[model samples]
Every structure is written in C-alpha cells, then in structure tokens.
Target: MSFVAIDFETASGYHPCSVGIVTVENGQIVDEFVTLIQPPNNSYNPHTIQVHGIHPRDTQYAKDFGEVFPEIQKRLQNQIVVAHNENFDRNVLIKSMALHGLHYEDLNIPNRWECTLKIYRSKGFKPAKLSDCCRVMNIALNHHEALSDARACAYLYLLR
Candidate 1:
C-alpha cells in the first residue's frame, strides 16, 4: 500500500505557514518532506503562534505555499492522503491554495483521504487528540510540529 501522510501549521486563519509530508510504500515510510511556507502575507496570529510555535519571522525566507505546492502534489497526487484532522488540513490546503490562485483539484489529490482522528474515535477512543492517540498507540509525538504530527499520523494509520 502506498499513501502520503500530511500536516499543516497555519500562521493565521486558514493560511498555511508550513507543511509536512511522509510518503509510505508497502506500509513503510520511504521519504519525508517538511518545510516552512511563507503565506500570502506575513501575518500570524498570536494564538496560532502559541499552538505551533511558528512566527512570521521563521518563514520569511521560506518558500510560499504556491512554491511549495508542486512538491506536495508530487508526493500526494493520486495517493491516499492521511491526516490527524482531515477536515482542518483539507480546508487549510484549499484556502491556502486559493490564496495562491491555485485550485486544490489542480494538484490531482486523491479524494478518498483518511482521518486518523476519526479512525481512533470510531474505535471507541474518546477525545482522540493526536497526542492522545499517540499515547494510546505507543507512538511518539511532538504535538503541533507539522512533521512530527504527520509522522505520528502515518504510524497511527499503519498500526490500524
């Protein structure tokens, strides 16, 4: 089985400030890509900064999401994408791409994505935060770090 696990950290609202991608083939992670993204503008919310510890200054020299999307699509196109919270990540991708005048479908991403958060909840785990699920599954997590969260999500999905 081949799939890509992804996670996004936002600077403010739905603006993606960074991305993480872990590509799994035959159930093993084969590659990983993580990068900070310069959003359309350098505006970051303090609350979001506290959540992900990413500030505008950190991404000032980073590529824009538009510049980053090609690599992301190369990893994810026609592949099953997994995220801890599919809705939020998907929305972030959509909104951020739109801000760059790109359509989400233009990336040819797979429609059938998996949500590990929902998976854990359906398995009778309450309050399936990424950290909570990681604890239950003996997976290591660094909470809101995009790459750490994506890697944890990939491990969680493989265990399932």
Candidate 2:
C-alpha cells in the first residue's frame, strides 16, 4: 500500500513545467512535494498554458529539470510510482530527464508505472479521466494542477 503518486505539467512537448509527488506509507500520505520547473529554454506553449495556467513567466526563474532531478530521484528511485495517466506522466519524466542529459536508467524505477486511469477503466468507470474519477468518487480535485492531481490520484488508488 506504500507508493509515490506523481504528476507533471508540461510547458511544451514533453518538457515538465511543474511536478508534484505525494508519498504514501501503509496507506496514509506522509509527505508531499510540489514545485514549478523551468522548462527547456524557459519556454511554454499557449495551449499548455490554457490547460495548467502556467505561463513562461511563472517558471522563468525556477529550477530546470536537471537542477531538480536530485529531489525527484530521492523520492522516486526504487519506489512504486503511481499516476492518473501513467503513460503521459512517465513520458514527461523520462523525456524531461533526457532533455537535461539525465539518464532514466539511473532512477531505477519500473518502466511501467501504476495507472489509476487504466485501473478505473478496468473496474468499469467510464470516462475515467482523473477529474471524472475524482468527481464520481467525491475526491477533491484541481484538475491540471500537478499537486492536486497527484493527491487526487493517490486517493483514487487508495479507494481502488
């Protein structure tokens, strides 16, 4: 029942503009980490901004993925990682690492993360986006905001 639930909001392409990690132990949340990240070249897409409300200016002075990898590594290495949409979040992590010349193999996490979206789908939850599942389960959510999404993903996993 112990795991780390993570979420990432991209600035453009697979470049992470923000990240959130929630650590759970014995089924209870024990720690939470969230930070805005400077994407490659501190650039952002207008469409992504509409999704997460994070503009280039929001992370202009924030640390880049390389600068923040140590923190991400300490939490995720050798841990059970979960996400609402595992494929997307995992790709963001891997691609962001690659963008910064960091190797994904060094993290020692599984290639496939536990996915709440897929899990809920299997259990017959239709329209199982993070927000949809959260709404059905009465879990509070802030949608594309990384920390809130991660926290909601964690709660949904616990319920599952």
Candidate 3:
C-alpha cells in the first residue's frame, strides 16, 4: 500500500498556512510537496511564531491557499495519506481548505490513513508529540519546520 505522510505548520490554529507531504510508495519516499499560504485570517500568534518562527511578513513567498490547492490535489492523488495526528491535521486541512472553497471529501487522494501517534499510544508509549515520540524512539528532530517535522514523522511512521 502507498502512504503519504503529511504534516502542516499553521500561521495559527487556522487551516494550514503551510503543509508538507512526504510521499512514500513501495517503502520509499519517492516524492514530496510543501506549500505556504497566506491565511484569510492573520492567525499568526506571537507565541506560536516563537515556536515556529514564521510571520506574515515571512510568508511573502507563499501562495494563498486557493492558488496552491490544485497542486496539492495533484500530488496527494491516489495514495494512503497518514500523519502523526491524522485527525487534527486533516481537520485543519478541511477547515482551511473550506475557507478557500475546497472541501475535504473533494480531496479524493490518499484513500487510506494510518495515524502513527495512535499506533504509538496504543503500544503504551507515554507521549504523542512528534518530538516526544522522537525522544522515546531515539529519532532526532528539528522541531516545527514543516519539511523536517514531516521527515521525522515519515521516519517514525516507518518504524511502526
């Protein structure tokens, strides 16, 4: 089965202002996609930015959500898309995309999902935070950056 491990960094709790999807097909990362978006609402909280180091000014290089949707759909097409916290990430994705007139059901890609955090917790692991999971499993991390976090999640998903 193919699985695309996806991760996102929001300007805030709003839909993903940025996202990274690591496409793993045949047990390898064959492709990946990252996109930055201008949020309809300035969900950029100073506290979160301290954790993520992104601000509206820094997002000048990103496309607005509407512009990147097509590319996102194209890349994620026909794969099992999974994440550390699949529900949370998918919820953010659904809501954020909704703001731009896209709906979750419309994203027909990635027909299956495996939430690594759920599997880890089910195994009696104490924490589900990606960094914490890394610590427990001895996977080093560069926290909060979408690509690096996505990379780490992909590795952790494989370990499971």
What value of lDDT does candidate 2 attain over all alpha carbons? Answer: 0.94
User: Whose lDDT is greatest here?
Assistant: 2
For model 1, what is the alpha-carbon lDDT of residue 29? 93
Candidate 3, overall lDDT? 0.77
Model 1: CA > 4 A from native: none
Every model's TM-score: 0.95, 0.98, 0.89
Segments in model 2 whose C-alpha atoms lie over 4 Å from true places: none
In TM-score terms, candidate 1 sits at 0.95
Of the two candidates 1 and 3, the one with more favorable lDDT, higher being better, is 1
lDDT tens digits, residues 43-91, model 2?
A: 8889999999999889999998989989999999999999999999999
Better of 1 and 2 by TM-score: 2
Better of 2 and 3 by lDDT: 2
The best candidate by TM-score is 2
What are the per-residue Cα lDDT tens digits for candidate 3 across 117-159? 8988988888688888999889877888777777778888888
| Higher-TM-score candidate of 2 and 3 | 2
Clashes of 2: 0
Q: TM-score ranking from best to worst?
A: 2, 1, 3
Candidate 1, residues 78-112, lDDT tens digits: the string is: 88899999999999988877877888887677654
